[model samples]
Target chain A: MEKRYDIVEIKENVLADNDRVAGKIREELRRSNTCFINLMASPGAGKTSLLIKTIEALKDKYSIGVMEADADGDVDAKTISALGVRTLQIHTGGLCHMDADMTFRGLKELGFEDLDLIFLENVGNLVCPAEFDVGAALQVMILSVPEGDDKPLKYPLMFKVSDCMIVNKIDAEAVFDFDYEACVERARALNPEIRPFRLSALKGENVDEWIRYLDGFIREWRK
Target chain B: MHEMGIVLHIAKTLNETAEEEKITKIGSVTLQVGEVSGIITDLFVDCWNYFKVRNEILKDSELKLETLPAVTFCGDCEKTYPTVKYGRECPYCGSYETWLLTGNECIIKEIEAETL
Candidate 1:
């Protein structure tokens, strides 16, 4: 007797399924007149700081929400919730990124009925977060000044996929030897339409420009 | 890394698939990974090896990965080029109207199982 094995041909795309869910979420957000922004960055890239500033600037005008995702802990969530807006912390348990399904569940928990803007503070990792769409109208990538300028070349996909790149911690430019122009040039080489913003979330430097851009974007999206 | 999460999902999917198909043991799993899928193949296999021992159905399973080249379609020039090289801009016509055609996919292509 010969041992036989059965080969099962299951041609299923894992990310495509996630994209489908993300597309559905996008449609739902559009119907509700909500602008969802997926924020990505390396650890300690001032993502929370930027969110705090953005929330402070826009919360009065728009109904805002924040979905803080981390491998573990709700410290960021606590910070966002102190502002008195809807906030939810999603512990990925150990995952480095949040997919569309996870974001959809987070949206369900936060209740998107009255929210005009939702910022998904994705887990602090550049590579993984860039891979998942998470149903955001805009994908924003933050690069801190201390992270060096060659990051765009190293992590091309992250820069390529991002709609806007925020060069945070510009206040530390005097201390760190970061080539701002070179970084912007590299990002432009990868993605020609990438809008690069040089700002410092901690010093409140150039944040108003970002706020203005977001205001325009949200207004256009709502229209 | 997120590869651990992906491996866990793959294992869960395999387990569910095996259960529905009445498979007692999975011999191997063939995954088609794209060049730009953001998944490191070596790390993914290592994660699978680490995870397989915990699951009886996948205890002795072998993991195989095939690389799918990344390609981008240029809408302006209507040409396809390797994404890893040309990126968002079309190399042929220097147009920014380009989108990814393939590669950025983590797909399960085949699964081999044994019936008890």
Candidate 2:
């Protein structure tokens, strides 16, 4: 006879294990006063370009470190390394996203504590990266004008998990039919506290504002 | 897809457990895939099939996936509702101050196996 299944209310999260591990990494970062950002988006959303601009703008003040988690692309990593910043490439091999364990490994490789700001450029995926926490202080995601406003509705988790949203490629807004207001409304509806920035990474438009905000945020986080 | 990586993790964990227990055949592997977990269901199944083709223990093992609906608890309303449909906000109170009660899961909940 089967044992009488006493319905025990087991309130356990599936990502709880990962979250516990992630919390450890977060504590490690906190102890060292290191600020880390997880940058996520769909492929070709100009995440690397934004990183390049941010590094160039703040390289003199803060020691920037980049951990590029890509399934195939190294072109971005190469570009970031060219800027004379400490950069590491994490080839996810065939995986679509980077987990906390992988980030921990990369952290060891980079000797992460020396960094003032560590940006983990997650694989350019709108979906998978939202599922895992890589122990970042903040999660920033990009939505290019070319991808359309409907992305906010379809991929809500990315926006929900992200602390900030970068609506990139405003320079190409004239050519695209993307509704800026609708995207902002939907994103705000999902996450009211999300910081939104409109910029063109390639054209270097409004990037200084982003860098300024980031600098201020880092200052606050440090304090 | 990344489901393959998840499958590999499951397989490795199951093998470790089986070796400790000295089991031969397996029955079912139950997984909890959250509604907003970001893992594709079809791709997980496809990866399981491909994995079974190479493994003997899981050759005929069944894959059971339980879809966990995303639910959250609102601090204002003091109730839990599906976050998959309406996220962060309480459906009744429309408050953004809420904690994610469930969802965002990708776990191997239970594994059944047999001894020789």
Model 2, B32-60: lDDT tens digits are 88887778899889999999868877787
Candidate 1: true contacts recovered, fraction: 0.76
- The residue-by-residue lDDT of candidate 2 on A174-218, one tens digit each, is 999988888998898788999999999999899989988999999
Clashing pairs in 2: none
DockQ-based CAPRI category assigned to the predicted complex of candidate 2: incorrect
Which digits, one per residue and each the tens of the lDDT, describe model 1 over residues A8-78? Answer: 98788756567788999999999999899999999999999999999999999999999999999989999
Could you give the interface RMSD of each candidate, to one decimal?
1.9, 6.0
Question: How much is B2 displaced in model 2, in angstroms?
Answer: 3.5
List per-model TM-scores for chain B: 0.96, 0.88
Off by over 4 Å in 2: A1-13, B9-26, B34-38, B52-60, B68-107, B114-116
Model 1 misplaced regions, further than 4 Å = A1-3, B12-25, B34-37, B53-60, B68-105, B114-116
> How much lDDT does candidate 1 score?
0.91
